[model samples]
Target: MEKYWNWEGNYIGVRQKDYLTACDGIILGKFYGKEIYDQNGNYIGEIGKNNRLIKNKTKENFRRPGFSFYVKGTITAPFKSCDPYPMIPGYEDFLR
Candidate 1:
């Protein structure tokens, strides 16, 4: 699994195949190609535009979906990974 970080370099989660697993081990969402969907199958965002891990264009999907919050101990610490893409100017408002 490849670890992902926010624009501030904070470890957010890992990308295991098609799923984005949080640091606490909860599966945050899944990727259908570059399109991201919540565990409930809601269209959230797409991973695109200069390799952005996620880009939420709509105001919807701002809240977490109904997924189990149990920590399954998937990630222990930040692993060696590439730095996240640079933050886009004026794009934060559309973030998920």
Candidate 2:
């Protein structure tokens, strides 16, 4: 499994240690206090401790319509994991 980081270069979370065996590279694990951002660097939300992507509701109401809300959903995209390569180096330091 691999780790992930936020746009501010902060450690966010890590893929489940045994994620490879469980889901073939899919990420599933506890997330630290990390804020998620959109492509334009806008604050989106944060991954909760329950491994759910909790979107920032404060910003959702005004965003473009038709955008799927992930407020209480888990990230199901298997390719969205931070494995193979991480945005920032040493993100695994928080694992300990």
Candidate 3:
């Protein structure tokens, strides 16, 4: 499971298996026949160009991206992921 960083470069969620998982290990979204669904199984988003997680513009609800234990602290990990594309605005509930 690789972590995804937000527009601010803060490590947010993760892509695990075929699901977009939160750093806390909660399943955020799932992949179904090429479409992405939220934890509640709502059609949420899709994989956009450059393999980015693009939120469904017509989605009724969304989930916020949470930080993981690996977030930059006193001692940061030597090498963490740095996603090229910042997280979508749909993940706006981040505190940091």
How do the predictions measure up, each by TM-score? Answer: 0.55, 0.29, 0.46
**Model 1 lDDT at residue 40:** 67
Clashing pairs in 2: none
lDDT of 1 at 28: 66
| lDDT (10s digit) by residue, model 3, range 1-96 | 455443444454666666656555565566674456654556666555444455555554544343343322222232354545555654432221
For candidate 1, the 10 contiguous residues with the lowest summed lDDT are 87-96
- Model 3 regions more than 4 Å off: 1-12, 58-96
Clashes of 2: 0
Highest lDDT: give the candidate number: 1
Tell me how candidate 1 scores on lDDT: 0.56
lDDT of 2 by residue, 1-96 (tens): 444443334344445432211123223222333544343334445544334334445544332222223222223333343323332332222221
User: Who wins the TM-score comparison?
Assistant: 1
Error of 3 at 52 (Å): 1.7
The local distance difference test score of model 2 is 0.35
lDDT of model 3 at residue 11? 55
